[model samples]
Target chain A: MITLRQLQCFAAVAECLHFRRAAERINISQPALSAQISQLEESLGVLLLERTRRRVLLTPIGRDLAERANDILKSVSDLEEFAHGARTPLSGTLRLGVLRTLGPYLLPHFLPEMRRRHPDLKLYLREDPDDRLLDELTSGQLDLILMASAPRNDDHLTVVPLFREPLWAVLPLGHRLAAKDSLAQADLAGESLILLEFGDGLREPVLALCHAAGSREHADFRATSLDSLRQMVATGLGATCLPALYVDAEALADEQIVVRPFDAPAPARSIDLVWRRTSARSPEFRLFAELVASHLPTVVTPL
Target chain B: MITLRQLQCFAAVAECLHFRRAAERINISQPALSAQISQLEESLGVLLLERTRRRVLLTPIGRDLAERANDILKSVSDLEEFAHGARTPLSGTLRLGVLRTLGPYLLPHFLPEMRRRHPDLKLYLREDPDDRLLDELTSGQLDLILMASAPRNDDHLTVVPLFREPLWAVLPLGHRLAAKDSLAQADLAGESLILLEFGDGLREPVLALCHAAGSREHADFRATSLDSLRQMVATGLGATCLPALYVDAEALADEQIVVRPFDAPAPARSIDLVWRRTSARSPEFRLFAELVASHLPTVVTPL
Candidate 1:
C-alpha cells in the first residue's frame, strides 16, 4: 500500500514538474524525492515517472494516476484542514481570495461585521480575478472565494448562492439615456458600452445579450478590471451593466451616476460564496457563507 | 467538539430510547452510553438529553442539534461508504433497490449478465415503488437505486441520469391502433388502458396528461407487478405503455401482441442510479453505474 507521505511527495513533485525544484518546494532531499517516487511505483505496481536525472516526465499512466492522486490528496488535506478549523475560538490562518471587482466594494459591507464577530479569525485577503481565484481555491491555496455567479465550470467548488442582484444599467448622470426612467436592451443599441474582458467573469452575459440584440455600440471601451470599468463609467465615457448591490448609497458616493432598470426579460447575476466542497475549512466557510447569505440580503440586494 | 463516538452513542440512544437497547445496539455498556452523553453535555455547555430509567427525550437545543447531528453523521457515513467502496471491488452486502414496474423485466434481462460480471456483489435486490426506493436510498440502507425521475427531496444524494427510455404502446395483435404505423396520444385517450398505479410509479405522469386532456378511460384492471400487466396485455385486457427495453424479443414473439410507436412528444422515463454524493461507495458505485449506464443505451432503447 502507498503511504500518504508518498502521495504527498508525488503530488508536490508532479505539480512543480522539476525534480530539484520539486524537492526544494516540498523541503525534501532530492534523492528522497527519487526514492519516494520509486517506492510509490513499486507499491502501486505501476511505473509513475520517467527520470533520467536531468529531466523528469510522467508516463501516460503516471499522468492519469497523478490527477487522481491529486483528488485523493486534496480530500485528505481538506479533512486535516477540517480538524484544524474545528477549534473553539477560531484562531488560525484563513486565506481569503475575493474577485478583484467585488473585493473593494464588498469588504466595506461584510468583512467589517465578520471581523467584529470573530476577532480571533486571522483572515489573509488576496484580490484576484475569478479564474485565478477558482484555480487557487481548488489547489488548496485559498479557503474561500467571493465571486459573481457566472462561473463557467464549478466542478470542485460547492457554490452557495448569496443573493440575486438585479441588473442595473450604470451610466454617467449627464448621459441622454440616464434621464430615462427605464432602459431596455434595444435602447442601448446605438449607445456606447464598456465591458470587462473574459477573465473578469462578467464578459459572457454582457456579450451574449449584446450579440442577441445585434447592438451597434461594439463595446467601444473595454476594461480589464471591474474598478477600472467603474472609473471609466464615472468619467462619462460609456455605459455598462452592473449588479444593483454595488451602486447602493455608500457606493454611489464614488461618482455621480444614474442607475436605471434595464427593462423586461432583464438579466440578474447571482453573487455566491463558493469554496471547494472537499475543503476541511468548508464548514467554516459554509457558516460564513450562511451568515452572508442570510444577513447581507438587506444591505446587498438592489431592492 | 463532539467526538464521533459520542455522536454515534447519542444517535443510537436517540433511536432506541431505552438505555439498555441503545447499549446493545452500539455494543457498549449502558453506563458508557450514559457517560458519553454526560461528557458531550459538558463539552457543549448545555444539556442534550433528558433521561430517566423509564424514558429518554431530547432537550430543545438537543432536538435542534439532532437535525445537524443527523446531517453530520450522514456525511460521515457517506465518507466511510465511499472509502470502503473505493478500497474493495463491489462485494459484501450490496442493498440494491429498483422500481417495481421496472424490476421484473429489468432484472431478468440484465441480472444474469451482472451476476456473471460481478460475482462478488451480493445484490440484496428489492422491488419497490419509486418513493420507497428513494426513501431507502436516502436513509443509507440502500446503496444504489434504479428508478425513474421524480421530485425527491435529496440534500445528500446525487442523481445522475443513466438513459432516457422512449415509451412504446403495446397492443393486442390486429388491434386498430397497432395496424397504423404510429399512434398519437389522442388515438389512445378514450381507449381502455392498463395504467399502472401509485406503486407502479407512473400514476402521476399518466394521470396528469389524461386528466389534462379530459380523456381518461375507466381502467378495466390495475396490477402491482409487471408480469401481471404483461399477461393482461397479452390476453387482450387493455393496451399499456411500456419502455422499449422491457418489451424484449421474447415478449414480441407473442403472435397475439403488437408494438407501435407512441407519438406527439413521446413519453420517456429517465432512469438514473442515485447514491449519496458524499459516499465513500461513490467511486465503486460510479464504476458499476458506468457499466450499467454504458450497457444501458442498448439494453434500454433497443439499438
Candidate 2:
C-alpha cells in the first residue's frame, strides 16, 4: 500500500517535474524529498522517476500516476473543505472561478447580495476561459465555476441554469449601421468583423454569426478584452458582437459605442453555475445559484 | 493537514456509506473507523458524512471527496504497477480497457503476440462503453483503453490512431441483397436495422447511416452484443451493419452470414489506443498499438 505522504512527495515532483524545485515548493529538504520518492519506488516495486546527474523525468507510469496523485491530494483538501463548509455553512472562504468576459460585468451585481446573505463568507475569485475554469474545478482549486452555459464535459459535475443573456451588435456611434433601429444578419454582409483573441468562449459563436452574415473575421487585429474591443469599435476599427450583460453593465458608459440587438431571435449565451457533482455543499451551492439568478438584472432573463 | 489514515477511513465509509461495512472493507473495527472519521471532521473543521439512526449518506462534499479518495487510492496502486513494469518492461500486470463490440474479436489476434513478446506480462482486460473507459482512464482505474476514434473529452488524455476498419452490411444467406456485388445506401431503404443498445459507441454512427439510408432501428428487440446481432441476422431475423474487423475475427466461420462492403467511400470506424496524458508508457503503448495494427487483417487498414 502507498502512503499519502509518498503520494504528496510524488505529486510535488510531478508538478514541478524537478526534485529540488518540488522539495522547495513543499518546504522540505531536497534529500528528504528524494528519499521519500526512492522509498515510494522501492515499496511499489517500480521506478516512477528517471534521475540523472542534471535532470529528473517521470517514467511512463510516473506520468500516469502523477495526475491521479494530484487528484487524490486535491480530494483530501476537498474533504477538509467539505467538513469546514458543513460546520460553518458559508462562513469560510469560497473560491469561485469566473470567465473573463463575464467577470468584470457580472460580479458587481451579485457580490453585494452574497455578502449581505452570508456575512461570514469570504469570496475569492479567479477569471479565465471556460477550459481553464473547468480544469481548476476538477482539480479542486475552485469550489464553483460561473461560465457561459454548462461545459460539454459535465460528466462529474452538476450545472445549474442561472440566466440567458442575448448578444448585441457593437459599432462606432457615428457608423451608418449604428443608425439602424435593429441590426439584421444581412447588414453584416461583406464586412470585416472584429473579435476577441482565441480562447475567449465568445469567439466561436461570434465567428459563426459572422460567417452566416457573409462577413469575414478581421484578420489583422484581435482584442485582448471586451473593453479593448469596445474601444477599437468606438474608433471605427471594426464591428463586433458582445453579450447584452456587458453592454448594460459596462458599454453604456462609453458614448462613442452603439449597441443594438438583432431581430426578435438573437443569439444568446446561457449562464450557468457549475460545481462538482459530489460536492458536500450541493444545497448551499444550489441556493447560492438561485440567489445569484434572482439578483441578475431583469434585462438578463433568469432560466 | 489530514493524514493518509484519515483519508483511508473516510474513503472506506464513503464507499460502503456505512461505518460497519466500511470498517469491514478496510479490516478495521467499526468504532475505529467512526473515530477516524470524527477526528478527520474535527481536524478539517467540516462535516463529511451525515449519519442518521437508520442509514449513512454522504454530504455533497462527501460525494465529491469520495471520488477523489478513489482516485488517490488508484494512483498509489498505479505507482506500484508503474515501478513493477519499469523494472521488467511489460512483465507485470497491465490493466487494459476495451470496448464490448471490439474486444471478443480483436483480443484473440493480439493476446498470443503479447504472450510471445513478453512472457511474464499479465494482461487484465475490462470491457465497457467508450465513456466509461475514458472516465476510468482519467481516474487511474485503467492504464490503457482501446476504442473507436478519439473521445471528445480527451483534453487530458493521449489518443493514438491505430487502424481504420470499414463497416460491412450483414445479411442472411440467400437474402435478395446478398447477390449484389456491393451494397448502397438506397439498398437499406425501408429496412429495420439491428444495433447494440445505447452506450456502445457504435450505436450513434450506425443510427446516422440508418437514418441516411431511409431505414429505421428495430425498436422491439435490442441485442446486447455483436454476436447476438450476428446470430439474429443469420437466422433471417433482420439485417445489420458491423465493422469489417469484426467479420474477419468472428464471422468467418459462420456460413449463414454474408458480409459485403458499400459501393464507394464506405463508412469506417477509426480504432485508437488511448491513455492518460501523464502516462509514462507512451513508447511501449505506441509499440503495442503498432503491433496490433500490423496483426490486423487486410480488411482493416493500419494507420
In TM-score terms, which candidate is top?
Answer: 2
Give the lowest summed-lDDT range of ten residues in model 1 chain B. Answer: B78-87
Q: Give me the candidate number with maximum DockQ.
A: 2
* DockQ of candidate 2 (2 decimals): 0.16
The local distance difference test score of model 2 is: 0.80
For residues A90-207, could you state the per-residue lDDT of candidate 2 as single tens digits?
6556689998999888888988988998987777899998888889887667878898867757567899888888778898877778888888877888788898876556887788
Query: How many clashes (backbone atoms < 3 Å, residues ≥3 apart in a chain or on different chains) does model 1 have?
Result: 7
After the best TM-score superposition of candidate 2, give how far the Cα of residue A130 lies from its true spot, in angstroms.
0.9
Kindly give the number of clashing pairs for every candidate. 7, 15
> Considering summed lDDT, which 10 consecutive residues are worst modelled in model 2 chain B?
B52-61
Across residues A1-303, which tens digit of lDDT does each residue of candidate 1 receive? 355567678888777778788889889898998899888776665555655345555543455567766765555444334333435333455677886666666666667777778876777799887789888776556767887763647565688777665666788878888779988777777666688876555676677667765553434667886567778888888888775566663335665677777777676666778876555445567778765664564534531
lDDT of 1 at B230: 70
Where is the poorest 10-residue window by lDDT in model 1 chain A?
A82-91
